[model samples]
Target: MNKLLFIALCAASGTTCAQTPATNPMPDGSRDMYVGLGVQSAPRWDGTGSRKVSALPVLQVQWSNGLFISGMSAGMHLSTDPVIEYGPLLAVQPGRDASGTGRSADGVGTYGPSLIGPVPEPLAKFDARPTRLDGMDKIGTRLTGGVFANYYVTPQWRLTSSLLYGAGNDHDGARLDLGVQRLAVDLGGQHHVSLSAGVAVANRNYNQTYFGVTAAEAARSRFTRYDAGGGLQDAHVGVRWNWAWSPSWMLTSNVQAKRLLGSADKSPLAERSTNLTVSTAIAYRF
Candidate 1:
């Protein structure tokens, strides 16, 4: 039941988005791994109109004991059933700063070297820019804990869900992601593509941390005070293409589009409600 297909899927989707790899059954001590590098073009932040290009690091590994690492998440499978998969998960949530530059967990090291460090300070604190988040408090990177479960409707289709907490500065943020994946679709030769669509829901704390603005912040920043409530956050769709040129070498790529909804979309920080992220890399199977 080795699900190699998810390797490319996770790589393209920003591994920190929180996903559980399919169960991989192997010899008592064997493992599977993939590592590579690529580039991604994505919005500076969740709702900003600005976009930036960053380096993407691809890494997915699963051991026979069920422990696995995919992008910025690590978890262990607890089920042996082919039709159902469950596991405890841990992930890193990227932080946000006044510069409107953050989101490190999009992929392993995709957001530059600021991954584990404190969010950078805004350089233009006195330059009242219309789009800058200056005067806002910096949100540091957080480690979230949760679980994931997936049910196979058939060999080619599956439903996926994961819940995680401990996001945001207060560490009270929580989020749930629900989605479905259409496994590999043969395109002849050694090429295949997978499709996925999903929606995210978050608690008030989670939404507020990213989208809300306090009175204190409003006094300094350009945005007025806003209190974001809990509800649907975003909807997304993605496609992954994998071309296995050889048994050990393959070209993997992904394109994902996401749109903010509810309070998140209406936030003053949201210069745009919709955005797209794209990445591609060449990986080696070991």
Candidate 2:
């Protein structure tokens, strides 16, 4: 439930991509792999304040040694204690700068190019308003690597935390997340429900790169100049459901609500602080 894992919703694949490992541990000599497709609604830009829906792929692999891959993240387990899981973490932090330019599988824009673009113009303009907010500087993807720690207080209660440092030039800043999760898995393994609540923090550089407006940007976007500082960026809660339809087939879905915090909430680009994201996918396990 780390808020930094998605770009304005579903930009790459068909859905917003976020994966929380399943409740059961892997059998010592076996592995479990799940592949899913989900859709999530996110802000139009990194602080744009408005939201749209996008779909993306989801996957998670848990192997013998506690090594796991979940969506855009992978890490190794450092502890043998069944109650606590922690180790090195590597992840991709999604970035954004487009004003609805994201594409979907049909080769059309995610929000539909007809209303935005795939062309040289704005489809809808409000008294010369759309032109001013037409374009933006592109934000490249970032590769982040760091440490992750999680504690399981009980079979159904968990605490998750992570710290990552960005390696990409796009937004070379650090990010941190702290969250708690609760999972309910039926003894028959036929159903599952999960809830997670967390908050994410970004450093000054990260905040500025994504939310700050330089003079040139102000001139281009027509938004007044604004400088953003680092601190708590977002707080979110997620509710997920899973159903095992058969021995190897499963279905999953989730809804997440996120609210901008601190400077991220006050940025001129923000339209609203509360963004609701939802996703669903059918997956397979072997």
| TM-scores for candidates 1 onward, in order | 0.88, 0.78
Instruction: Tell how far residue 240 is off in model 1, in angstroms.
Output: 0.8
lDDT digits (tens) for residues 1-286 of candidate 2: 1111111111122112223352245567887666766565644554343457777566666677767677676678778777776788766656454454243221000100001212122122223453224444655666678887777777666777777887325547776777776655443557666566777777887777666677877787756688889998777666666666886676666666666678877776655556555556777665
TM-score of 1: 0.88
Highest TM-score: give the candidate number.
Answer: 1
Error of 1 at 280 (Å): 1.1
**Positional deviation of 104 in candidate 1, in angstroms?**
3.9
Worst 10 residues of 2 by lDDT: 106-115
Candidate 2 ranges beyond 4 A from true positions: 1-29, 46-50, 100-135, 167-171, 185-189
Pairs clashing within candidate 1: none
